[model samples]
Target chain A: MKILVCIKQVPDLESRFKIAASGTWYAAEDLAWRLNEYDEYAVEEAVRLREASGEGELVVLSLGPERAGEAIRKALAMGADRGVHLLDPLSHDKDPRQIAGAIAEYARGEKFDVIFTGLQSQDRGSAQVGLLLAGLLALPAVTTIVAFSHEAGLVTVRRELEGGARAVVKVRLPALFTCQLGLNTPRYPTLPNIMKAKKKEVRTIAVTDLPQVAALVRTEKLAFPDKRGAGVVLEGATSEVADRLIAILKEKTTVLK
Target chain B: MKVLLVGEYRDGKILPSTYETVAFARKLGAAAALFLVADPSDLPRFAGKLYLAAAQQCGEYNPEGHLALLLQAVQAEEPDFIVFLHSAYGWDLAPRLALALDLPQISEVVALAEGAFVVPACNGKLRRTLRPLGQRAVLTLQSGAFNADGEPAGTPQVAPLTWAGSAVVELVGYEAASRGAVDLSRAEIIVSAGRGIGKPENLALIEGLATVLGGEVGASRPVVDAGWAPHERQVGSTGQTVAPKLYIACGISGAVQHLAGMKKSGFVVAINTDGDAPIGEVADVLVVADLKQFVPLLTGKLGGV
Candidate 1:
C-alpha cells in the first residue's frame, strides 16, 4: 500500500512573467511560487489512498531549487509521511529526460507499490516526465487519469483522452499514474498539520550526487508568443460597448444575420 | 533528413491528425515515411515508405506493443527524426519510444523556427524554441498546427512489421465521457465562460447571453473543473473542439488549450477585464470591461435587437 507522489513547484499562473536574463526561461525574481495545480491533486490522491489502506507510508518527492522544499512541506502538511527533495539550483534548465532520470535514480530501490505524478508541470508543460520516469523504471504507466481505484494488487484508472473521451485501463502493482484535474479536491493544510509538517523529515539529495543524465533537448530561446493580431478594443460605458459589439456582430458575422 | 511519421488508427480508421503530421513532414521538406498499425488495403496514399503492422497483433492502444513495433520500424528505416501528432496515442507512446531508443523527445511542437522546435510553456504565455542535442530525436506536432491539403501523391513501398512484445498494461475498455445533452461542437454560436466570470452564480449571465444570441452555453476548462459548468459544455483541447459561427468568450483569458477548441470560429468576441489576456490575441473584438457589468448589458441589448 506504499505510495509515492511526485510534485513540482511552479510559478503562479497569474504572475506577470518576463524573459529571464539567461534568455531561456522566465525571470526568477518577482514570481510567486506555489505547488503546481495538477500536482496538488496527485498528492491528495496519494494521501487518500494511504488513508484508505489505514497503514501505509506515503512519500512526496520534488525536484527543484531550494524553494521547492516549500512544496514538499505543503504536501507533508496534507498528510504525506515524509518528503524527498532532489535539490538542484539549476533544475529549471533540465529537460524532461534528465528530470525523469533523476527521479528514476532515486526511486529505483524504493519499491513503492504505486507512483503518482501530475499530468504535466505548469512551467515546462512538456507532459513527458511521468511517462519517461515510468519507462526508465520499466513500470507500466497511465497519463491524465481523472479516476482511479486500487484493490487486490490491481489498479484501474480512467484516462481523459482527446475530445472528452475516457479510456479505462488496468495495471498490476508497481505502476505509475499521472493525475489529472477533478481527480480529487486537495485539502488545505490546517494550522496544526502545518506545525506538524515542520517536524516531518524531508531528505534532501543533491541532484549532483545522483547519476547524471545528459539533457537530450536544450532550450534555444524563450519569447512571448506572437500576437495573432491587434484586436479592436472597445471601452467606455457598458451600454456603448454593448451597442458597438452588436453592430459589429451584425455587420461582420453571419450569425447576427 | 529522413523523417518517420507515425499514424494513429482508431475505430478502424486513421485519424485526421496523422495526415496533419504528414503535412508537418512535408513542411519540414524532409524525406518521410509513414507507419501505421492497420491493414495495407486501407492505407492512405503516402508518398514514401509505409510501415504496416496488423492491428490485431498490436492490440488496440497498447503502448508496449506499439513501442516494439515503432522501434523495429525506426531500426529498419534508420530515420533521423520520428514524428507523431501530439495526440492521446502519441502523448502516451512517444516518450516511451524515445526513452527506449535513448533519444530526445519533444512534445506539442507548434512551429519550427530556424530548425528548432517551438513549443508553448507557462500555459501558452511563453514560447520556447528547443534544439535537440543529437541528430536523432522524437517529436509530436501540436494539433491543427499544420494543414493537410489532400492525400499525398505517389506510391509507397509497404513494409510489414511484427511485434513480439508481451503487454504489461491491459486496456480494459473505453467509457465515453458522459456528455449529458449538450454538444458544443454543433452549436452555431457559443457564449463561453471562464474564471474571469468571478463566481459559479455568474454562469447564469453567460447562459442568458447564449440564449439571447440563439446559441449554446460553453465554458473553459477551469469553469468546468470548478463545477461552474457541465463537462459536456466545455470547449477546449481536452473537452470539445468547437468552430461555431460566432463565439463570444466571456471572461475567458484563453489558455492555449481553450483556444485550440474554438480558434476556428467564424468570428470571435472576447469580453474580459484584462485587455492583455491571450483571448485578445485571437479575438476580433476585445471588450475590456467587467463581465459582471458588461455581459448583462450585452445580453439585454442583443435580446432586444
Candidate 2:
C-alpha cells in the first residue's frame, strides 16, 4: 500500500503580518513559517495509517520554494518514508488550480491507494485545491473528514457539516480525503528520528515540467481591516468597571433591566 | 452584469443563505437568477428568474454531480457572474466548476461594493479588497454577510435546465452533528467564550455567568478544538447556528465562521481586551477589558457563587 500526503508551509498564525513593499502580498523578511495546522493533522493521519497497515510506503508532498523543503523534512521526521518537493519560485502565491494541476499531473501515474491534504491552507484559506485535484484525477473526493476507518479497499469516513452535523461516506480505494482539525493529535519527532530524517531523500520536481495552467484569479489589492473609532474603554478598578458595565448594559442593552 | 445564483438545499428545505446570496449578487449590479438542483418548494418566491434541474442522482449533496450540473447551467445561461453561498455546497463545487470553466473564483467574500470585495486573511487578522481580473468569475458569499430580502417584487420566470453527467464520487450517508445536552438553538440567552478567555479553567467563569443569567454556555472553534468545550456546544460555520435573544461574547475575536452563527442574535455584548477585534463591528455594546477580570467581576456582580 502507498499513501500520499500533501502539505504546505505557511506563515505562523501568531506572526504579525505586514504587507510587502510591493503591496501585493505578505512581507517575506523575518517571517517565521511552519506547516499549516490542518496539514499537520493530515501528515499525522498519514503516518498513523501507514503504521497501522504496517507495510505501506508513506510519501509526503509539498509545492513551494526552497523553504518548504524544511516543512517536508519535518513531516519525514514525523514518520513519512520519503518526500516529494514540487519546487516552484512563486510558491508564496500560486493559484489554487495551478497548484492542483501540477500536483494531479505528478500523481496521476503514481497509483497511490489514497491521498490526504488539509481542509484548507491557513494563509490563503481558499479551501479548493483538494477538490480540484480530485476532479482532475477523476477520483472520489471527501472534504472536512473528521474521522475514518479503512479496510479491504474500502474507506468509511465521517465528514463535518454545518450545525455540528457529520456525514458518513463510504468510498472505494484510491480516493482522496481532506483532513480537518481534531482528526488526531500530531506526534512530536524525537532527537534520533529527527537525525534519521535528514538522510531521507526528497525528490525535487520543477514546476515548469508539470502541465501548464493559467491563474484564474489575480490579487488586486491588499489592505488591513478598517480600524473603527476608539471604543469606550471603561477604566478604574474591577468593581468600578463592573459598575460601569452594568450601567451600560441596563441603559443601552436588554441584558439588564 | 448577469449573475447566476446557485441555491443550496438539504433534507427538502432550501438553506436560508440562498436568499441572502441573491441579495448579495444583486448588489453587484447583476440581474441575479436562482439555479436550483433540488426541489424548490422550500425556496421563497423571488422576482428574478428561477432555473431548475431535476437531476435524479443529485437529490443528495455530492460535489461532483453538483459541479457537472452547475457547468451545464453556466453553458446554457452564459452569465458573467456565478454566485453561491459559501456553505459546504459552494465550498465543494465552486472550485471545480471554476477550474472546468476557466473562470476566476473569489471565495468567502464578506462584503461587495462596486465589483470589489472584502475578504479576510491571516486568520481574520487582515482584510483584502480584491477585484477579478476577468469579466467572468465565480463567487461565494460568506454566510450571514448579507441580509435576506423579504420584500416581494414580481413573479419569476421559471425555466428547466438540461443536465447530463455522472458523478465520480458516490454519496453514502450523512450524520448530523449531535446536539449537546443543551440545545443552543433554542436558548434565549447564550454566554460564549473565545480564545480570549485565556485558559480552560476560565470556562468556569463563563459557565458561572451563564448560570447566573439563566442561559447556556457556548464557545468558539478554538475553545472547542482545545477540548474545553464539546463540538456540539461550538458555534460557527461547522457548528450550530443560534439566534438567542441576547448573546454575551467573552474574549471571542469574531472570525467570519464564528460570526456566521451568532450574528443574528437580537442583541450582542462583546467583552475583549482588544478594541479592534472584528466582534466589535457587530456588537451592540463593546466593552474593552480583560475577560478574565470582567467576567469574574460581572459574575460576582450578578451575585453568583
Candidate 3:
C-alpha cells in the first residue's frame, strides 16, 4: 500500500501576531515558524498506516517557500520514506484552490491508495484543501476523520460531526481524509530515524512544472486588519450580572427578548 | 438562465436551513431547481423540480464522489450557476466541485449580485466582489446567509432517479443527538469568555452577559480545556460552528481556532486589554479598556434593568 500525506509550514501556534500597517494580514518578520500543528496529525496517521500494514511507503509533500522544506524534514524525520517540496514564494495571497491544483497536478502522475491532510490549517483556517484536492483528483473526500483502517480495498473511518456526533464510514480505494488533531498523539523522532532522514532523498520541484499556474487566480494585495480595545466585567452575583448584561446588550441592539 | 440548488434532508424531515437555500435559489433565476437527494415526502415544498438521488442520505456525500454525481447532474441540467448551503457536507465538497468542473468557487458570501458575488475575504478584512472564471459557476452560500425568500414556494415537481451505484462510500453508523440542542449555526448572538477572564467561577459573569444578549455563551479552547466551559460551548476548529449576529469576545487572545467558529458574525466586538491581541485585529468595534472594569459598567447602564 502506498500513502501520501500533505503537510504545511506555518507559524508556531504560540506566535504573537500583529497585523501589518495595512488591514490585510500579519507581519511575518522576526516571528518563529514551524510545522502546522494539525498537519502533524496527518503525518502521524500516514506513518501509522504504513507501520500497521508493514508494507506501504509514505511519501510526505509540502508546499511553500524554501523555508517550507524545514517542515517536510520533520515529516521525513518521523519516518516517511521520501519528501517533496513544491516552491511557492507568493502563497500568502494566492487562492487556496490554486494551491490545491498544484498539489493535484504533481500527484496526478503517481498512484497512491490514500491521501491525508489536516482538517484545516492553523493559520488560514479555510478548511478547503483535502476536499478540493479530492475534487481535482476525482476521488472521494472525507473531513474531520478521527480514525481509520484498511480492509479489502475498502477504507473505514470515523468522522466527528456537529453537536458531538460521530459517524463511521466505509469508502473504497483512492480516497481523501482530512484529519482532526488529537486523533493520535504524534511520535517524536527517534535517534536513528533522525539521522536517517538526513540521508533520505528530498525532491525539489517548481510550481511551474505543475499544471497550477494557468488556472491560478492572481492576488492584488493583502493588508492587515483594524485594532480593538479591552472589555469590562459586571459586578455582583450571576443573577444581577445576567440582568445587567442583558440590559446592556438590549440597549445596544434590538435582539433582546 | 436556470440555477441548480441542492436540497438536503435527514431522518424523514427537511432541514429549516434547506428551505432558506431554496428561497435564495428561487430569486437567483426563474427556472431554478433543487435536487432533493433524499426521500421526496420529507420536504416542505419547492418552487422547482426535486431530483431525488437513488440512496436515502446523499450517499454520505464524499466531495469527489458527489462531484462525480454533480458533474453528470450539471451536464444534464446545463445550469448557469450552482448554489448550496455551506454546511459540513458543503464545505467538504463545494470547492472540490468547483475545481473538478474547472470553475472558480466563492464561499462565505452573505449576498449575491450580478455575475459577481459579494464575499467576506480573509477574516473579514474586507468584503470583495468575486467573479468566477466560467459561465457556469459554483458557490456555497454562507449558512443562514439570507433570510427566507417567502412562503413554501409552489410545490416543486419531484423528479426521482436511481443511484449510479458508483458512490464508493457507505455510512456504517451514526450517533444521533438530542433535539432542542443549541445549534450555533442559527444562534443570533453569542458571548464568549477567554483566558483573560480567569477561573471557571468567573464564567457566571460571562453568563450574565449571555442572558442579556438572549444568546448562548461560548469559550476559547483554553477555557474549555481548563474546564471553565463545556466542550460544547467551545468555538473554533474543535468546537461548534456559530454565525451569530453579534459576537462579543471577552478577554480572549483570539486564536485562529476560536475565530474559525465565530468570525462570520454580523458584528464582532472584542474586549481585550492588550492592544496587539489577535482578536483586536479583526473586531469591527473594539474596546481596549479592561474587561473587568467595563463589563459591569456596560451591564449597569442597560435600560431593561
Number of the predicted model whose TM-score against the real structure is largest: 1
How does candidate 1 score on lDDT? 0.89
Write the number of the candidate with greater DockQ, choosing between 1 and 3. 1
Candidate 1: tens digits of C-alpha lDDT, residues B1-305? 89999998875777777889889888998889999997657877777789999887767678888888898899888998899988778888889889999999988999998778999888877889999998889999888888798766677789989888777888778887777888778899999999988899999999898888789999999888888888988898888889999999998888878998999998999998776677888999999899999998887887777
lDDT of each: 0.89, 0.81, 0.71
Q: Evaluate every candidate with DockQ and list the scores.
A: 0.73, 0.51, 0.28
Error of 1 at B8 (Å): 0.4
Expressed as tens digits, the lDDT of each residue in A104-152 for candidate 3 is: 8888888888999998777665577787788678777778887788887
Q: How many clashes does each candidate structure show, in the order listed?
A: 0, 2, 24
RMSD of 2: 3.0
- Colliding residue pairs in candidate 1: none
User: What are the iRMS values of all candidates?
Assistant: 1.8, 2.8, 7.6
Q: Taking the tens digit of each residue's C-alpha lDDT, what string does model 3 give over B1-305?
A: 78787666544556666776766765675477776556645655775676666445455544434566676677778887777776666666677667766776666556665766765543343344556665777777766556685667567676655544554667777765323355667778888898888777778877887776577888887686566777778787557778888898888877645776787777677777765566766576566656676666555544254
Candidate 2 C-alpha error for residue A96, in Å: 1.5
lDDT of 3 at B274: 61
Query: Cα deviation of A30 in candidate 2 (Å)?
Result: 4.8
TM-score of chain A considered alone, across all candidate predictions: 0.94, 0.90, 0.83
| CA lDDT, candidate 3, residue B20 | 65
Best by DockQ: 1
* Per-model root-mean-square deviation over C-alphas: 1.8, 3.0, 6.3
Clash tally for model 2 = 2
Q: Candidate 2's residue-wise lDDT over B1-305, tens digit each?
A: 78899887766666766787777866676787778876644434677777776635465666666777677778778999888877777887787788788777888898875677777787677776667767988888877777766753466677866555655556666776777587798998899999988889999999999988889999999898878999888988888889998899999988778988898898788888776667887777788888888888888887732
Overall local distance difference test of candidate 2: 0.81
